[model samples]
Every structure is written in C-alpha cells, then in structure tokens.
Target: MNGPGCAAGFRHHTRYARSMSGNRKRILIVGGGYVGLVTALRLQKLLRRQLKRGEVEIVVVDPRSFMTYQPFLPEASAGSLEPRHVVVPLRRVLDKCDVRTARVTRIDHARRIATLAPHVGDPYDLRYDELVVGVGAVPRTLPIPGLAEFGIGFKTIEEAIGLRNRVLDKLDEADALPYSDPRFRELRARLLTFVFVGGGFAGVEALAELEDMARDACRLYNEVKREDMRWVLVEAAGKIIPEFGEELSDYTRQRLEERGIEVKLNTRLESCVNGHIVLSDGTEFDADTLVWTAGVKPNPMLRDTDLPLGPKGHVVCLPTLQVKDTPHAWAAGDCAQVPDLAKGPGAYCPPTAQHGVRQAKHLARNIQRVMQGKPPTPFKHKNKGAVAGLGLHKGVANLLGWIHLKGWPAWFVHRTYHLYAVPTLNRKVRTVVDWTLALFFRREIVSLGTLHSPREEFAEVAAESAPQPEAASRTPGQPVPKAGAPKAG
Candidate 1:
C-alpha cells in the first residue's frame, strides 16, 4: 500500500476498525466482465435489505465502463447488429453498486487491500472485507514475426467495429483501381484477400460472417467480384470447433468450402511480414487483413496477487467457487480454474459464456450462504451444448449431445438463444429491432474508419495554417506567402 501521495494516510486506517465502527462490509469485485456484472446484479437482489440499510457495500472496478456481449461480436462486425447494442453500459445496470472505472494493479489478500490505478489520477489502495476476482482471460498470442505489427484480434467491441470498417474500406480500395492493369490486379487481390488464424469458434464465425458481408457488397461494385476475394482459415489442429465432435466439424468444413472459403487443416502461419503471409505448407500469399483468434490465456495480472494459482496461471478454486485455502475470496469465469463437478474428477469448467453465467449465479448464492453461517453447496451444471452463427441464414448447433441442427434452423436457434442471454431488456429490444429492420432493408456497407482518427484532417489543416519560422522573421514590408505557393528568393 505504500506509494507517493495518499498511501501513507490510507495505510493508517485499520481494516477491522473501519468495519467495526461503520458495521458495514465492503465487497470488492475486481472486474466488470461477465462474472463480475452478473455477480453484482445477483448480490443486489439477495442482499437488497443490507444494501438499503447501508450494512453492505459492493464495489466493481474495470478499465472499461461497459460489458460486451461477446457472442454477438461476429454479427456486430458484419453489420447484422448495431455496435452499440452489443455492449451493456455497466453504470446503467449496476446502479446500486459503486462502479469504478479503474484497473486493479495489485491485490494483497493477506492485508485485504487492492491497489487501483485510475485513468487520470494517482494510484491508491482500497480496503474490502470480501473480494471477487473475475478479471477474465486475454487473447493468447505467440511471438511470431510480423504478427504483432499486422494482426487483428476479435475480442472487444472496438476491434469488432474497426474490423468491419477496415473490411469495407479494403473493398472500396479494390473497386477504385482499374481492372485492366496487371499490377493493379495484384494489388487488388491483396486488398480483397482476408486471412484468419485459428479454427476455433471466434475465427470461424468471424471469417464466415465477414466473407458473406463482403460478397454481398460486391454486388454494388463494378470491378470487385465475389470470386476476386480470397477467404482463408488456417488452423494448426486437424479439426475446427472440436468441441462439437467430428460430425459437426466435418460438416462445417464442407459447408465453408461450398461458400468458396479455403479451410487449411494442420497448417501453421510461419510469418506475415508486411502483409505477405508464409504458411508451414510452403504456401505464400499477400493479404491486407489478418485476424488472430487462436486461444486465450489467464489474465497475467493474477500473478500479482497473494492467492494460489494452478499450473496454467488461473486462480485455483474449489467446487464451491471459493479460492482454495483462502476464505472470503472467490473467483470464476475464464480466469479461475473452477472444478467441474458435473464432469467429475480432474475436470474444470470451460471458458464459455454459458458456464460463466451459471457460475456467477452460483457464486453469488455461495457468498450469501457463508453470510448466513450455512455450508456452501458445490457448483454443478450439465453442459448445454454449443451454437455458432456462420453468416446470414446459416449456422450449426448441437443440443443436449443428441440433437443436431444445421443451416437456417441452427441460425434461428443461435439468434434466439443469444437474444435471451443478452444482459438487459433494453439491449435485447434494440438488437431485435436491428434484426427486424434488416429484413426490410439492405445491409449498410459504409466504412467509418475515420472514427479511429477523427482529428487527422483538422490536424493537417492546422499544420498548413501554422506560420513558418522564415515568415515570422520576415521584414514588415515583405509579403506574407500563401500556403503551397511559390517561394520568393
């Protein structure tokens, strides 16, 4: 807790004395992601009286103020859903709790203090009686050549929308060039080619959705044809969406091939230097877009805490979702290695939205059980299968291990399930509205890349208007020269 400005005074306050005097217990949640938001919501209902009587306090902290519904990311990127509708603003929903838009730099469980680094102000320590660690996992990346320089990740809302604009902009670039020239053809091919690494749900869904959108957009362009674009999916594994089993995996691959997508199995990307991709199969191609969605690793921030972690760096949690050997500390979601009692011994819950949602509710109940001096129940839930959207009116689903759905039926199920799963009623209505309007109208293919750098044009104008040193030093009789005009000797 020792720091420059406020740490000395903050350390002076004893944790026990503060709780003793106020008769209030503070619950600090380290993240505002899936588990964090849901846990806080459940706690509000379970401990409503204590919260109203000022007997309990809940604090949620995260860098971003909104919780993104990740399942709808592909649709958002493909313009099927509005970008704003996919992200729920935390402040609006968790109105009862104190939401802090900051990052927890470190956690000291032995002292019950968490160091928070705000966006603007100084870093400070926060004291809490109970702690919930749900910081979530980050995209697992490899140290590949040129990967960091020219790789797009499909995780957050910003990246999703940005990728959408970039794809459309590439189409625009290709359309502007003359088709008769051979040099322009090569350049156009590069611009139109899209490469996605990893055969997981994220890579498949993103590649499929964007390719469909780009194909539809080609109808309006005179030069860019659907055949001119190349959509390639590179996976090191022999199968895609392996969790869905071999039957669905083969079906998915065959379906993607029918749509003119190249699915390379047991392939690895050796390098992508300056947009030129080199694969392990000795294939080389120039591309303008590369998206990496290989896998995810536990949040590296967990190493800064005093809690015990598994070999994979995830916080080890018992069947009750409590951190092992640590009382009053809980964890779940992608960052915690929670024992999957439903799956039996040596098994852990997979990092999926379905499990995270269920774990949050269960973890909230366990917290209440401890408060009531009752033994916490073990967390258990049967696997609900998996569903994925490929493109407009195309999908695949596996329900209850016995039921299999494909094409439009699976697509409908995907949409319906996610609509029911999205956080708030407001977002659900807005998403449905977007889908309803899409039925009567065409998809908007406009590229809004300027959103990234809105001030570029203004900055250029200001630089042009700026007075030069020579102009400033000129005599009073000398004429002031106009910008970009000839200079007098």
Candidate 2:
C-alpha cells in the first residue's frame, strides 16, 4: 500500500524497502510553538522503540529556546504570575527529541530539505522524510501612522514582562515631575494614559489585568491616584470578548466601564503618531503606552515553502492534518487550515491553543497509522468553551455554548483551566506557588525598565572615559603626530 513511508509519485514497494534499510527516517518539525512542541513530544512517545533503535529521528526548530503558555501572559504582565513559569524550556522538556534553537528560513518539500538560520554560525540545510509545518502566526498589523515605532504586542513572554515594567516606569516618571512644572501636565497626562487596541481575549485580558495591578499599585504612590490614570480600550467591533457570547460580552464591557476604563466600541484607532492616539470617533489623547493585539496572521514563511496554502495564507491541509498534494507532510496550529468537521462543510478550525493541542495529538496518531499502512483518521473535535479573566476575582465564561458563568465562579474556572492546561508538572507547580503567595502578599509593582537597556550606563561610561585626540592634531591645519613622539594628553 502507498503510505507515508513511500513518497508519492515513486514506486511504493521499492521506496518503502529503501527507507527501511537506510538510516532512520527523519521527521523535521518547524516552529516550536504549541503545535510543534506537542507533536514532537507525542511522536517521541509513540515512536519510542524506533527512536531508540535509530529507526526514526525527530528534529524541532524554533527561534526561541522555550515554548510559552500564552494564556498566562496577561497575568504575567500584571505580575500575578511569574513570567519564567509561563514558558517551558524546549531542551529541558524534550530530552528525547533534537531541539535546535534556530529559525527556518525556507523549506523545499520537493527536495526534502529545509534551510535553517541559527542565532550563531552559518545557515545550513537539513533533509527529512517527513515535515510538519507548525510555525505559529505573527501579529497582524496595519499601516497606522507611527504604529510600527510605538505599538507593543502582547504575544510573547518578553513582551509581557516589558509591558509590566513600562507601566510601572510611567508611574515613576509621572511622580518625578513636579505639578508646578510647565511640562508636568502634558507629561503626567501622557504618562498616565494607556490605550489598548483590540477587543479580543488577549487585549481585554491584558487591559483588565494591568488596570487591576496599576490601580492597586497606586496605593504605594503618594502622587499618583487611580483616578489620575486614564485607561481606554478601542475596538472596531461593536462588542468585546464575543467568544463569551452576547450577555457575557456586555457584562465584560459594563464591568470595565464601571472600573472607569473607557470602552469605545465600534471604534478604530486611526493613528498613534508620537504617542498621540486618534480614534475613529474623533476622540484624541496622548498616551505613553499603546498596546496592539488586534489580530494575527499565519506565519509568512508559508509562502517560502513548497506547501500549498489557503487563501488566507495558511498551509492547506486535509482533516487528517496532512498537507494537501503532499504525502508524509503535515501541518497544524495557527499556521494550518484544517477542515473543521464539527463545524460542517467549508469550515476550517479556528486558530487556537485548544484546537492546536488536539490537532497535534491527532496528527501524531495519524502519522503512526500511516506508518503501519493503515488509513489515517480525520481530525474532528467540538469546541468546548472559553474563559476570560477580566481582573482579580472577576471573569466571564461560556460553557458548552449553553451555560454562562460570571464573577468569582468564572474567575475560578479561568484559573483552574489554565493551571491545568500549562504544560509540564514543574510549570504547574511554580504557577500555583505564585498564586498561593499572591493571596497573602501584594503584587510586585517595582519597575525594572532599565533591564531593557542594561548596557546603557556602561556605554555612557565608556564614551566618557575613551581617549580623545589632541585638539591641535584634530585641527584642519595641524600636522599629524609622530609615531615615537610623546602623546599629548
């Protein structure tokens, strides 16, 4: 039978025998995000004997050395959860698989080769029998003025940590300036104003969590009051958190407004040039911080590959998660367009961690079936529910598309779900410990903004201490110094 081991367009029996006789078949997985990490781990478990006997090998490549549990990012940004605990070190966790910290520049499935660019050293090509494209999406940005220069995204652990420090640093800046100073009003106004564009889970959660933390943090600042802080959320859609259904969405908006946060629905951010925020509603303000979590697009690397892509630039794949028109090639996660059987004809699964996790498991099993010369089963799973943590002890959830939950109960569910979902027992324990300690202790509000440019001070010192050429020698008419002459100090 023609199977994954047998390359398409080739003689199956001969190729299968050659594959079996040669060195272990290599499975190269790209983009070590949720999908890539899970697939590699699952494959390692399923092919334990093959891996040990050198019958099969797996290699995972990603830019980052770790896989971040993105759901906890808002909490990490607000200091409710430790940032380090939100990420799983790929090398530490995937001991059985070869995890390379590199970026895949291009992939040539026809030639069974991929070009990798490591952080240090030259780029190299790797050959593989099977390829899994799990490279996740990148932030979808627009041509808004000054956005590229100012907007911050809430996607990675570093971004979360940097955001936390930035917020606190703004408070410090506001405090340092005297009220009587001419620039104080404008500086304080700008420093205290924070704008978040996007009504999705990432934007809302980040806004709510940071607002909660900032409000609480004000208690420690003599000059800064919670009332002085201006928080705004701008969404082009009429509602926020639409995934939580209409009622809960309204409730979330109401709760946010009640907290003095300006929720501008059906509004768009027209521009943010030089920290000045202009909205479609004609409202204008100066904000030191502008966070953009509007949306995400599939990784652009898909275009550089031999794989077929959907109209939206996602890797086109069958329900079985195998790349279309290609045997022994598969894809899943935000990068792949997997047909959603549960959603009926012409529907594709939404890019989400839930779907990615399930797809990874199914992808592994289907590959195993292909290896055993069995027909691959299609991947199908119903959407269970979505939970959103609005702030401390405040949340909303939609369960099974029928049951709606709000308040503390929803918050509990939100935390409980993520606590269980974050990969690795070690991370789970660390996250729980952070929450437990937070129950009794206040959140850390200290700003480590200098960490962003830790070398600045050293650079300044070096510039000050560096030897200068004598003034006369530097003059236009002056003669050059002799090689053996005493140097002019």
Candidate 3:
C-alpha cells in the first residue's frame, strides 16, 4: 500500500502547511495521466535542488495509482503483450514527489485551495501555490437507448481485458452445444456477432486486433469456424482513420472488409437494446457485444471549478498552456483547448499522446520560468505523422503529411514507433521481450474469465454443501409450514 514518496499517514489541512524553516511552495498536479505524469517527472528533474532543500513540494493526485500507456492496450487485449507492462506506477517513477491516490473534487483558485476526496478517510482541503489540470477526458457518449448498459468503451486496460474475456467466454459457451441444436444456432450467431462504433484510431485498431485474435482462436475450437463469426464496424463519418488521410483510410477499410469485417460508413447506430442492433440505414441484427469509441469529452470535474472553459467544455488555455484569466492555474492534454500556433489563429492542438507529451515538456519549462520570474514561451508544434496497425503484419500510415505507406511496412512502423513511445525503459524491455517470444510461439489464447469473479465457484459450492436446516419435526407428508405463523406449533 505504501511506496517511495508516499507519506506515512494523513492529516487535516495542516498537512499542506509550508515548512516553518524554508517556506516552500507547493505545486499540486491534478490527474496522474499522460500529461500529469510527464509534467511531474520533468518538474522533479528541473527542481531537484529545491526539492532536497524543502523549497518546493510536488504533489500528484489522481484516482488511479498508475499511468496507462494507452497505445498498447489493443495489443495487450490480443495477448500479444503483457497487460502489466502497459502501465507505470507513479510512486515508483516519481520517487522525489508525492503521489496520492485521490480525486480532486474542486479547485478554488481564489482561496489557493483544492478539495481532495481520498480513496479512504474524509475530504480535506490542500493549499497550493500552483496548479496543473491534466484530469484527461472520458468517453463521449450519446443519449442512445441501452448504450450505458450494453456498450463498452475501449479507453482503459480493464475494459480491454473484460472484452477479451467476454469474447472468449462466449466462444466457450457456444462450443458446449451441438451446432444442429436450435439454441446453438441462436447463441452462436449472437455470441460471435461483435459490433464496434466509431471510425477513429481506438475503435479501428481495437476491432482489428480482436478480430485477429478471434480468428486465431477458432483453430482451437473444433465446432467453431472463423467464417461463422461476424464483425461489424459502424461509423457515422464518411471514413475511418481520418487522421491518416483518405488514401490510408480507404486502404484500411478495404483491408478490414477483405477479412470479412462489415465496415458500414455514414451509418449511425440508432439503438442496441437487448442485443438488437438497429442502424440508421434500416439494417437490423443481434450482437451481444458493442464497443463505443465514438469520441472523448473533457473531464466533467472542470464543471465543478471556476476555471474558464471553451465551448466544448475544455479548459480555455492560451498558447502558453496557462488557463485563461487565471495566473496560477495551468492545463494541458485532452482537458485543455491549447492554441495551435503552428496552424495559426483559431486552431487548437489535437488531443493525442504526442501532443500531451510535448505539452508537458513545454509546461514544465514554463512553470520553472514563472517561478524564476521570467516570461513563459508559447507552445508550438506540428503533427509529424500517424500510424495504425491492422492485425499482424498489416497496417496503414502517413508520415509528415507527405509519405504514405500501407501493409507490412506500415505495420512495422506502427510497432517500432509505439515501442519507442511507451514510457519507462522497464516496460519497453518487457514489451519487446513479449514480442520476441511471440515470434517464436503462437499467441496465448487461454482466457481467464474467472478472474473477474474468482469466488463464484467457491460461493456456489459453499451454498450447495451448506447443511440444510432441519425440516419442521411434524408428521411425514404434512403440509410444509406454508405460513408465517409460529413454526408449525
């Protein structure tokens, strides 16, 4: 439960009081996400002397204790990589800073205080001289019927694992029944029908990788055939993988369709209640699984604060990544509408890992400059390229907005780029090892669905073997005491 940089115990507001001797300034970084982790690490390196002398204290608060390298999530779910290698523990990485597992409920900039609700214990106010908002975004959802109950989002590792387990579990269930049985026909059709909404990178890559896994897994099931499964991708847009341009997007769609995936363009999912999918084009089907990766919206926590937000509910930030009209507040990553100076006026940086990492570097330097009583520099950068993998040894890419590549070369670029981009050398080495071993061995197809409810079997056995209460000692065949009256007195 404890790690380096973690305090031993909790206290009231007094815990954030400045040291009587040095009067150090406290910098509270909200959200242990891509931007927050990078910013905190860079700040620690920049303020090493101040940290040792107690002249500066860096505190990072997030609901999760680790930062997930999201790019590798699809591969993780496909069992081509280890899930644990895709996340880095904040406390271990930031040994000099404080990493608190808590949610920042509100920020009162006027009072220089932030309200934090920890995983345990009471809520408290922590005073800070500087604040960095990087709470990140959540899945953008619509008011579609049954979406909340039936649809899954491909945002986190847990969701990816759950999807993998659920898919495999369905396959296992379908295998137990004879194909000729009526129940088998219905169950197999429903179980193998997977629907994915959205045409973006997350949705496309997830569908591709999972489809690859499912096809490979079919070889192990005697009753299941790869052609029997149906994979559907519905996008309201005109094309998928818009980041890679029209050529690559078309190529990506063609590749998916060649693999028997139904790529429905300009089609919206009207409803998916009770596994019944109704599309805008009047197409109807039953699919037990539906993945929603339509888009992402800024963290709703910004609504609780007084920070100025843009039209889309993202924090309004200047070119310098400083919150508009607030001197001490700063924001970046998906939560901030950062001006894209490279694209000129009216253009903001896209919310991607590349921009988030770059913004963190700039934000750290700017914070240090402000601390030294110097002016901050504006953040300016242009997108370099984009890459997307389509299963094993297949992909599409566009480099520097000029060079386009597809198939094996793009796949290599996708892996090479992400392997280098994922944070931490330890994780990088582990992931590479996973890939190396995978080359020599087949992909692991075993599903540990029981991990979701490890106690279910034991609970069932306990209930079944539990001693039955003695029946009422009455005449044999006497009507079982059907009344709430005094135990058949």
Candidate of highest lDDT: 1
Poorest stretch of ten by lDDT in candidate 3 = 3-12
Global CA lDDT computed for model 2: 0.90
- Which pairs of residues collide in candidate 2? none
lDDT of each: 0.93, 0.90, 0.90
Candidate 1 yields a Cα-based lDDT of 0.93
Give one clash count per candidate, in the order shown. Answer: 0, 0, 0
Per-residue accuracy of model 1 over 55-154 as CA lDDT, tens digit each: 8889999999999999999999999999999999999999999998989999999999999887765677788899999999999999889999999999
Per-residue alpha-carbon lDDT of candidate 3 for residues 179-238, written as tens digits (9 for 90 to 100): 777867877899889999998999999999999999999999977888889999999999
Q: After TM-score superposition, what is the CA distance of residue 396 in candidate 2 from its true location, in Å?
A: 0.9
> How far out, in Å, is residue 478 in model 3?
25
* Between candidates 1 and 2, the TM-score winner: 1
Clashing pairs in 3: none
TM per candidate comes to 0.94, 0.91, 0.93
